[model samples]
Target: AQSVTQPDIHITVSEGASLELRCNYSYGATPYLFWYVQSPGQGLQLLLKYFSGDTLVQGIKGFEAEFKRSQSSFNLRKPSVHWSDAAEYFCAVGARDILTGGGNKLTFGTGTQLKVEL
Candidate 1:
């Protein structure tokens, strides 16, 4: 079974400062990783993903993540953050469950809340 862990439950950053959110996974083989962001009343939006090929992946909203197999990490980073960026961020890993007829599913972290200061 695969799982994800987000070390920090909450993080605060200055409006224009840089930011990085940690995401670590426990999986046997090559894992499919993703980063998503959700606002107060909005659904999860895909930030970035790593399936294969390039280790460094770029995503929407000026976000990017690098997949590090050696470290078992896929950390999200942004050069600068806006006030609107303050939201709940999630790290997820896609896995297949044979118990469920070999269907694909995602294991998500508890999430990390971002609070931006002006």
Candidate 2:
């Protein structure tokens, strides 16, 4: 079964500090990975994604992530986090359906709460 796990339930960082959110996944083969951010009472916004290509991928808002096959991990990072960046971050893993020939579903982790201190 494919699954995603986010170990951190909450994190606090001073504004302008670097942040890293850990994500782990389990899948039979190479899986599509994604990172999303959600503000309070708002829909999720895609941060980044990895299907196949460079291991390190850049995302919006100065965010980036690295996919590690050996470790089954895709961790999200931000060089400098702003107060507005404080929100819920979710990591997801996707698998393509053999019949559909496209990724139709994704398994998301619980999520990590990010708090920024002034």
Candidate 3:
């Protein structure tokens, strides 16, 4: 079975400070990875993805991540985080050969809640 694990249940960061979130996965083959951010009472927005190719991928809102196969990790990083970035972040793994209505399904982590202080 494929699964994703986010070590941090919650994180607090001051406005304009750097941030990093940890993610780990378990899969038989190379798995598709993604990070998403969800604000209060809102749908999730894609942060980044690592399907293949480059080990390092850049995302919107000054966010980026590096895929390390050996470590089974894909960690998200941002040099300066805004108060708007304070939300629930999720790490997800795309199911391979497992499609739901022709599109890949996402299994998300428990989530990491971020609290920002002004």
Best model number under lDDT: 2
Clashing pairs in 2: none
Candidate order by lDDT, decreasing, is 2, 1, 3
The whole-model C-alpha lDDT of candidate 3 against the native structure comes to 0.91
Q: What is the C-alpha lDDT of each candidate?
A: 0.94, 0.96, 0.91
The model with the greatest TM-score is 2
**For residues 10-97, what per-residue lDDT tens digits would candidate 3 score against the true structure?**
9999989999999999888888999999999999999998989999999998999999999999999999889889999999988665
In model 2, where is the ten-residue run with the lowest total lDDT?
95-104
C-alpha RMSD of each candidate structure in angstroms:
2.3, 0.8, 1.9
Deviation in angstroms for 8 in model 3? Answer: 0.5
Candidate 1 Cα outliers beyond 4 Å, as residue runs: 96-103
Between candidates 2 and 3, which one is better according to TM-score? Answer: 2
Report, for all candidates in order, the number of backbone clashes.
0, 0, 0
TM-score of each: 0.92, 0.96, 0.92
lDDT of 3 at 53: 99
Scored by Cα lDDT, where does model 2 land? 0.96
